[model samples]
Target chain A: MTSSTPASAWSRDDTGITVTVSGAWITSRLDQVGWPKAERSDIAGQVVVVDFQKIETLDSNGALVLHRWIEQLRKSAATVELRHPPAFYERITDAYAQSRTGATSPPTGRWGDSLAEIGHRAIDLAKATLHLLSFQGQIAVKLAQTLVRPRQLRAKSVVHHMQAAGVSALPIVGLLSFLLGVVTAYQGADQLARFGAQIFTVNVVGIGVLREMGALITAIVVAGRSASAFAAQIGTMKINEEIDAMRVIGLDPITVLVIPRVLALCLMFPFMVIFADALGILGGAIMATLALDISFGQFLRQFQTGVPILHFWVGLSKAPLFAMAIAAIGCQQGLMVGQDAASVGIRTTAAVVQAIFFVIVIDAGMSIFVSILGV
Target chain B: MPFIEQNFAEPKPEMMPAVRVRGLRTQFGAQVIHDNLDLTINRGEVFGLVGGSGTGKSVLVRTIIGLLRPAAGQIEVFGQNTQANSAAAQALRRQWGIMFQDGALFSSLTVSENIDVPLKEHTRLRAADRRAIIALKLQLAGLDPSAGAKYPAELSGGMRKRAGLARALALDPKIVFLDEPTAGLDPIGAAHFDQLVLDLQAALGLTVVMITHDLDSLYTACNRIGVILKKQLIAGTIAEISARPDPWINDYFNGPRGRAAAFAGAA
Candidate 1:
């Protein structure tokens, strides 16, 4: 085969055929002969082999044609051999295969499709905002109903929700927290002991636990667990038309459903934080006893000395704020739940993600404020 | 031909009507039911409304009691225009009661608690007085007094309906609208229910505007019958409706079921 517009290729067979791969004016020399790829080794046999002896340099398209030809030979029962294509041919072939599998797919114009989608999305968003605005009056009425009917958001109900979310979850929280403290203490003691500071592991563990990390961890766990609870409960109620029933009967669904939950969570979080802190400290004491050979009494003495009373207060302060934000975000998404029950699961998931995200953001801010205060 | 030469039970029009609906028009969407419909409900009267489904008999009574607002009409309760947004309109509403098809019983509250709701809302009665009144209404509705402590969920369909009725009468409403009050009941159950309605109407002097598909209810309980068809009312007794050759009227009163009613009356 030679590089020609009306191209050709030659086979060793007596009744041979010459095939050309041509596109526009420009064509490569290898186009005159179809490239060889994979084929069967013997006539009327299916054992595969590749023959590239008749073909030239393996540019990607040439290699592709060669592959096709070889595949055809392999499908039929025919013996084949390849002199192994030129280096350029192998390189182009490898590049093409890598691209086909890799992050870069042959451009099917997804980038253009994506841009068009974004434009359509922008228009849809604008329409939705306008639609939601018309419901502003309804929102105000709902809010008023929620606030005025304290019976709906009764203090009794808050206690019930808190008991389920906070009290019932106590066992898992306790187990996880005790292990976390033990791990922290063991790791921290080893590092501190290198500098003759094994006793300061009390300070290290105490400072970390009573400060942001302990509270942050607890909040994240509860945010994932409790916040989603609020969203799912309320979202399910909304879908069932139970919320509408409340409204028709002159009751405030939000106060009855949401306020109690938020209040309960706010009341519950600080206690959970305190419990977690205690468990974590106890865990550290166990680690300290085993690793540093420190007696429990001595560990207590070190802890008392290192972790000031003020640190406990600082840690305790973050719990209520964290709980409030988590519960608020959860209830908000729940109230925003759509008619479909599937949206209940979706909103609950969103609530958890959003609550944890805000917890981290707020934790960062808390750290800065605490540093400035020098507690 | 006069359809009512033989109305066994006739309305004495000399007495004051408890409700007077004039030119009532209730429109939802493009359709108008109660289009220029007029009806007068007399004191101590069980007024039966018979209609093909969706002819707006429900809408007519709903508009009169202000449960639904009529598009254009004068609903005068005790001679006061109910559409007027004055204290009188609400006062007129307070004078009458309505029982919806769904029971509309507050599901969250217990039966006793549900009965107490309207009393608590409107009356200055003390808790003890409210309890006594609620108990009386329960007994009057033929509900078991023991069932009072149970929530709506625990109660059967028949019990919920009775409990709902107890609540409707809690405020001592002078007029009561019962829409298909005996629906979904056996023959004997429906008969006892009809008797209960007649008793309540007599006892309370209530002018009952009852919308029912039950031909038996129309024959037995109603002092005056109004047929709603083609968005207009053909007002008279059952026999009056029977003789009217208006195809829809004939279909209602001279058709197979109508003939059976006439046969039963003769027997």
Candidate 2:
């Protein structure tokens, strides 16, 4: 098919330049022959002829390209005429002819557009934050109501969420905290070995893992995992009009959907933190025994004596706060999802990022408060 | 000239039907949907396939389009076997377009860009030329040119269906398959859509296969009707099929809604 087409060419004549095109001008063949161009300078003021007599095949794409070329020539002040065209040429050209003459160019991005966009985004963010805060207030009121009548809680849904957000998360959180403990103990042993104080590794691992790493690691993992999951699942339900149906059926989405998941995370998070702390300390002991030649009995004695019980309480207390922020942001983002599929993805991403950001911010604030009080 | 004339020209005995399905069998696991179904859609004719819900109307269309492999069958389009994985089958795909139910336009793209997708894939037309074609297609589909810039999510149901039609006709395909184009539309909108389908079919000389439950659509748009029953297809002209004594056909054509549509179509 490619070999059959003579390349479309133009010839000069006394009548004008006759742009002769031959062989299949169909879409597949057009790629090889390409759009035929006549020299604009030569035909600008002259009558140019588009001879379509020898054309073997012409589809809409071909006709469109021809019509576009003819329009371009006419725009250049050339009197463009079809010469020796077959009967079908008119039919094909007219079928694909553009009714809208002007191709409107997209608006160019001006410098002020960026500023305006930023302003718009800022307003949207502010509105979203206010909406989230009000939603939190609604959750608090609902929580109080549910407390008064505990039967209002959907126990099955709460159990399901506990399994998903808590049980399913155990392995990854445990693995990461254990690895964190091992690294902390190894690093502490290296530093203390220089001064023949390698026995201090137990105190370093116990203090670091119990006070900071355990709660922070568990919170970060849950924020990344459950936050995105919550946003996506609820956003899909919103898209499917399930939320609207729930409203019509007199079931509050906050009570039926959001609260159970949030409640489950709140109940489960402190346990996760405690579990992480135990595994982290165990990892530290193993690393100390292997690297510093410290006996398990000696490491336990040092940890019991050197690490304060207050450190465990400090970490465990932060768990519920972190869980609240993460679950709230996830559910809020899910409820905020727009009508389109792309918005679900955007909301899910926002849920994860904002949850992590808030968790870290809260941790920092708590750290400052703890430091000021010399905890 | 031959390419355009071939569409309107009477089919000689030597010419191939646009689509031919013979002894087709489709099953999902142990449950059979269609058994020994035979259907032939001639060139330049609007063929409507009607069946009750879950009667494998969609499954038949999907099997014919090679989206779902049939349990056993021979399906041919323009004399080329559709089941083959050869280059000819690839080229044959460009000869037809399928418009799914719900005007399944890409949610991310504007309507014009959705139309441009096929042109971009199948043709080497420049951006300017493709844009010109998109505007023309939008006009042909009974849409305003301004609608080209709006995304699918922005359009109403009727306009979205029109946009889907525009995209389907982007390459000027010889055959078009519409899956319930008029389903979920208001009476006026459905009538308008049927007229648009007829006008485009006449203008482009398309061989259209529409899977529709809309009796009004069958009455007005289709030249031939095929009813799927008892895992087999019974095909004939609308008048001929309506004449059958089968209880299902009798119920379908003589039902109150069907009678109203038939009367409306006649008037």
Candidate 3:
């Protein structure tokens, strides 16, 4: 990497300051020779002569550095002159210099820009909410119309989405529900042991898993997986103009794309909740038997007698609302994707966040409604 | 001193072409696109490459730029072997630029930021200098100065192509490879683009390898033309190659649209 290039240096002579630049001044070697910085005192009221006579090579980057350094010296009120430079230095730098005449530089970020961005985001959020509400109304109308003409439902696509959103989701849903059940039972048994009533842990596990944990955990997992998938798939299709193609061919994209996914999630969600309940109760029974000194038979008996059937229905009842919200948010974000690769990623993240947020909010509302009815 | 100085800006008067390909083979799996293809693009000339769809026009460009490895044979740019791992070969890379079809600009960056990308990476110039050069490049590509602030998605189709050209010219590359430079522009827009390429080539003394389907671009801009057929390249000047008895070449050059473009070029 070593070369016999002279280091660029400056010295004061009787005439003025002569800065000699030597070596290959191309981009690959510019850092080695380095640019000369002028102090105001050194060149105050003196003409600075930059001698480029000994420069071995020059490229665009080298010329730019020289041009900029000279501009800086002239700005400091020192006269700078170049001596015996290669013909290409002026040729390259002059082209860029000419472009500075009419060009507006990029805007720097300001406090006003930040405030405007916040205002824009607030408006975007309001618009998105309105869009989602309108989309939901459209879905409701389409669903009602499809119910009247069942053959228009695209049964094959619905079945495909069911298998995709439900059948493949079994292992994850089952495993997470079982773990939730175990944690609930173990924690309950420990707390109950302090009151000398460890056997009542069965009631805690049964009531908790059957009423809330089963539905909430399954919905969260599905929202994370299926919702993001739906957003990304539809977003890519929208970017490729496949959605436009379908519309031009007289096929309603809402009927063809949205209904099947929403219907699949709505129909399959209850079955997923029921499967989660059984596994969750099974996990609770195992934990009770091992930790609370209750036999599996005793745990089941307590779970059946202590937890009412209404509590199981209370959890199962929330599944359709959660599923619809998740699916709707996912589809809405997909439809909203702008024309870029970055927006697909942005919308997929928004789909998961909105779906999970709405799920929790809806669950809280449902809990209040059920409590008001004394269910 | 001249021999040892190694000045890239002033390429010495030499017989070497800007790009040289010898016995190059390219393939995807069992499907061979170019087999033992040889090409030579002279320095300081506008070279147009035309071929039927699925021919290896883009593939050859990719191989020459070291994006795709050649299955066999060699590629050289400015007399340096492209496949070499030497420091000199690495330095040789900065000498050329490529513009893909459809103006593949970075979706996140503004057009000026896009042009600034290579300069920022390869040079230590101050920020103001880089911005000045970005404005220069945008002007050279025949774009308005205000266009530098807009993202690629916001630009019109012709503007996007010009932006892509501006980015390619950012580093003042000696050789530029342009893939389908006028594929989607209107007729007038495409003609304006052809003139822009010719003007830039003349002003910068660039060796331009353009892959195009526009007969107007071929007639108006190119100093020579290369046609890919049956996995081989047939290359010569417009008059020389059009005189060949090849059926596709004859159909391509003497076709109605081709004749109209040729008449326009003559006018």
Candidate 4:
């Protein structure tokens, strides 16, 4: 036990030879020890024994190193025997031997396996979609019931969630929307100037920013920010058994956790749309004035006269639906989190992806419906 | 030649106590969990830390394992100050293993991979060798070799605790700390776990510090028990503790539940 370094000694006797391995024959010490290399000449027609009794420690690495040497000696016509292996070395050696013979390889049915895997994944996706839809229906019922009895509504929680999901998300939404407007205005100015129609850039920028880019950018940003945050917060509460505790205390998690968040997002999305629309138009105006040599007042007058008020209303109408989709998807994913720490991370990522995808799909449908109605 | 001879002739440093705590104080905002608490765990002893709920048993373990910083006082493991961010403290970490309540296994990693984590971090062993070690550690923890490929979530509560124990013992640590090792287990399972701890301790000469509420485990495995009360630790043998006149300790040990557990332990 005092020796930090592992060592071995060989002794020859009339009956056989004994190799006593001693002093921490662990994986970390294997490199330090000089492994005994047996020769056929010495081992032929004799018995060889490897003793591990004196070893301070013997892990799998040490056992394998010794087992291989013993196997070699036995193959050379020597009667090899292992003596006094540490408590679990026998099991380690048996597993190592079995693995060496490829007994542990996964069974192969390549084409069938691939087909089954794909089918399994498809079914899982369908099941997950159904579950999410059911959760959405439950939330809708809860929303209606609360609307019927407004006193039961958690107003403070709704306001708190608004501050978290909406107020805190303004800067990023504003920045991205402004950048989008600038890029669109710059690109449109190039095409319009080529046709001697530079003033038309204002109409293009105003319509695109007010009717599409402003609302779309804000939804995507909120989906990324608030959806993931809601999922992580709820998933952690589930893991900590706080959700169960809330149930025991006679509180509905949907009422306390889900409703407030969904309502907050729905209320905030329109305000965010308005704010982003202003910033985006301002960005377009600035670009037009500088890039096209148009005066600021001229750009403003053209933007105001060219973009119809109906287009702005059409864009604002999509905000509440987009908000509801994002919030519902996020809360549903959170509630679906399994009782494990890693499930929290997986569900959070899924919440963000699903929320963004749903938001885009809704926006596309809204755009088609508005155009069909001649808005 | 004389200098080399002198260096070679010096005696090795004596092994220090497994754990030592002096004037340890911990607090959370206005709450004081432990104030001026002191403890010493000698080498090669099964030390039990017992206390009422909310007495900071888990917190104390966390503090000693360097997870939580003490508000005041010093902790030393193997003569190295645990609070210092020094190389010696890093080396000292390899000397002890900890098993948390509920196993706390990484849900993503299979049982074998969980055991392999410490081996991979601390050694330069080949993959084959590491695999062999994983298998060995699994068997030592009384688990089937087939359990290696399963995730922590797949294992039952008792099996998860065994897997956690396997991971803890991976590095051949001199000391092992178990937080509530037998909680949430059936009597048979808890007894089996106790026997496993005893067998492993005997085989490895490990100094075990376990926080447990099971009186059966206390009577069966512990050589000494440290009770936490009034923000302080009172250490003694089980018999000594049972003899104390403190109302809580008296009811806890001589109560009907305690008597049944003691009888079971004796059997």
DockQ values of all predictions:
0.01, 0.43, 0.42, 0.34
Of the two candidates 1 and 4, the one with more favorable DockQ, higher being better, is 4
Q: Kindly list the per-residue Cα lDDT of model 2 for residues A115-173, writing each as its tens digit.
A: 99999999998998898789889888998888999999999999999999998999999
Candidate 3 accuracy as TM-score: 0.89
What 10-residue stretch in candidate 2 chain B is worst by lDDT?
A: B5-14
- Give the best candidate by DockQ: 2
Write out the backbone clash pairs for model 4.
none
Q: Which run of 10 residues does model 3 chain A get worst, by summed lDDT?
A: A1-10
Residue A56 displacement (Å), model 4: 5.7
Residue B48 in model 3: lDDT: 97
Backbone clash tally (model 4)? 0
The DockQ value obtained for model 1 is: 0.01
Candidate 1 TM-score, true structure as reference: 0.44
lDDT of 4 by residue, B51-98 (tens): 999999999999999999999999988777899998778877877889
lDDT by residue (tens digit), candidate 4, A191-253: 888889989998998899889988999999999999999999998898787999999999999
Deviation from native of the Cα of residue B72 in model 1, angstroms: 1.6
- Span of ten consecutive residues with least summed lDDT in model 1 chain B: B8-17
> Which regions in candidate 2 have their CA more than 4 angstroms from the true location?
A1-21, A33-37, A49-51, A76-78, A83-98, A101-105, B1-14
**Model 1 over residues A1-375: C-alpha lDDT tens digits?**
132332233333442222332321111222234233323342345333343443432323334445444546656554444444456445434443443332322236655898899999999889755643443344446546656875545767877988987898777777778888998898998898799888888888888888856687789888888889888888888867799999999876755776677678878888899998888888889888888888899999987887898888888899978987787778777887875555777889988998898898888898799999876
